[model samples]
Target: MLDPILLWSGLVNGLLQGAIYALVALGLTLIYGVLHIINFAHGSLLMLAMYGVFLLFSQFGIDPYAALPIMVVGMFVLGYGLQRGLISRASHGRDENILLVTLGISIVIENLALFFFQGDTRTIDVPYAFDSLEVFGVFIAIPRLIAFAAALLIAGLLWLMIQRSDVGRAIRAVAKEKQGARLVGINVEHIYAVSYGVGIACLGAAACLLMPTYLVYPTVGHAFVLIAFTVVVLGGMGSFPGALLGGLLIGLCESFGGLFLGESFGQIGIFLVFIVVLLFRPSGLLGSRV
Candidate 1:
């Protein structure tokens, strides 16, 4: 018997998954917006945080959830340093160079994971891993719910920062016109570092939020990174809100595609949507050339 309830549950689960993808993709879009770099290493950074949480739990007996703050702070500093020292210094008329360097960095990180973790899969076994709450007669998994909520919270915070704060305004200014920003005495290099830091912090935060429900594998970042990239392209490279909506839309498509087509085709369905979106809206839903 095909249960209508199960179908609805699948829809919610898909949305939850989408929420995590959106979180990571938004970070990707931000970096791309300001830095104009694809940041192939962003996914590896996510893997690093995942491993960071895994080791913290194995060594210190701390819950991965409880270690969220530490991961975010650590990754933020790592990103800032990477940008300030490596990216900023090398980004003089050499965007493609940075891309290749970051891709190489990602390869190294993945290999390190393989060497250390030995291709074994691991996951955090939290009590609430599969727990759920009933909403409007539908059951929603707690991890997904928390992840989804965190997605919104982070998005809101990001918007507030960009629209309100001094540093945030500087980021926007630099993104719009680097020379103009320099005319106003805004440090373009520092702004780039700050934006990159926020972007990387978001990836780490997503890793911690997803630890309870996801397995820790060397290549786990590979799975979501493509989806994140697709979301970024669909949402518009420089558009933050576009990333969120694109993620959610992709989520719904995956859920419904699996329901109607097959589970194996769900990801294929997202790429198909990407194809269609690109064919029609190359500039994206909200992208405006700055």
Candidate 2:
């Protein structure tokens, strides 16, 4: 039997990891909610943002946290441009077309990074790399704590934006009824781009928060793609709060599973929970009826 302290530590770690997972999934869910398409390129975009943070830190000696605003704006521009200049033109009113386009984009991004960065894994060392916070006899890494706080703050802000902002209202209007939104002079195409940009912006924040503890490579995004999808599905696609809760739950499972089942087999728990959820509650924990 594991010590109670060990179990507590595992749970803490899992919650920390889950917060970052929620941050990552938030973008995917938001895009799906607004655009109604699965962005196969999301992981690739995350990979790109990680690279952006890496380059800034490596070349300019800037801290990852300090680069947050820069990355968010840059990614937003890239996402906006992609949506306005390519995705919209290519989508042609078909979700399948958007899927293909995003898939192609992912492939292109991976190859470009491979060609440019040569697939070498990169990591950053911050001043607080080894720092930790002691809480009730448990030591939690500072970076993990920061990630948890930042993720929650961003999620809250996003929820508020969606719930209260005028632009957000336009986004919802377009998401629910594009023709009606257009009739009301909501620049439907621009709203699509903005929504996509906001979705990608979340990844920018995620990359910065993750860089202090995570490594990056051309294929790093691949590792996250599966987990992100799981969170989205488990949380109920297009539901922000659902994604948040699902992420934390998945994180706990991974943590406890690793403790009891060993590292190699730990992931079995995630799959088990995923299957069980699908079998019983397909709509998800907080998701509405499908």
- What local distance difference test score does each model get? 0.86, 0.92
lDDT of 1 by residue, 1-290 (tens): 66888678778877888888899998899999998899999888899899998888878977877888898899999999988897767666498888987898899999999999989999877887879889867978788788899888998899899889999889988987999999999988888888899999998789889888888889889888988998898888879899998888888888877877789976788878888988888877667643
Q: Give the TM-score of candidate 1.
A: 0.94
Kindly list the per-residue Cα lDDT of model 2 for residues 91-146, writing each as its tens digit: 89699999999999999999999999997999998989879989878999898899
Report the C-alpha displacement of residue 34, candidate 2, in angstroms: 0.9
Which candidate has the top score in TM-score? 2
Worst 10 residues of 1 by lDDT: 281-290
